[model samples]
Target: MNAPQVSPIGGLPSRGFAEPHQNKQQAAPKNDALVQIRCSKAAAKEVKRAAVEAEMTISEFMLVCFHAYMKR
Candidate 1:
């Protein structure tokens, strides 16, 4: 007996075996809402640093923080 091959991406089955969802189009959601924050130059720099440390974009970092706040 022989084992099937796998794709490096998504750990999905390869060799003509594809899931239905995998074939569907995936798009980024539209940004319909906006929130603005004002801060000093130092504060802005700190936010940038923190976002980088967390390996997320500035927008992602902000959303994560906002979600955490809402959960509390």
Candidate 2:
């Protein structure tokens, strides 16, 4: 009987992760529609500042906020 082989902790790929597919033209995004929210200049500046502080794009920040609101 052969001794059992030990697996690495993470079981990650040994040769490195596969590269992203090349030259695959992506279809136009279906969720590209924009829903504009009008706010004061100061409010907009604060939103931008918050997004920067959170290390996220403005769109990502807004989506996070939306999800949080929906959760509540």
Q: State each model's CA lDDT, in order.
A: 0.74, 0.75
Regions more than 4 Å wrong, model 1: 1-34, 68-72
**TM-score of every model?**
0.38, 0.38
lDDT of 2 by residue, 3-30 (tens): 9999886895567677766544364456
Model 1 — which ten-residue stretch has the worst lDDT?
A: 20-29
- In the predicted model 1, the residue pairs found to clash are none
Cα lDDT, model 1, residue 39? 78
Whole-model alpha-carbon lDDT for candidate 2: 0.75
lDDT of 1: 0.74
Runs with alpha carbons beyond 4 Å of true place in candidate 2: 1-34, 68-72
The per-candidate count of clashes, in order, stands at 0, 0
Error of 2 at 18 (Å): 37
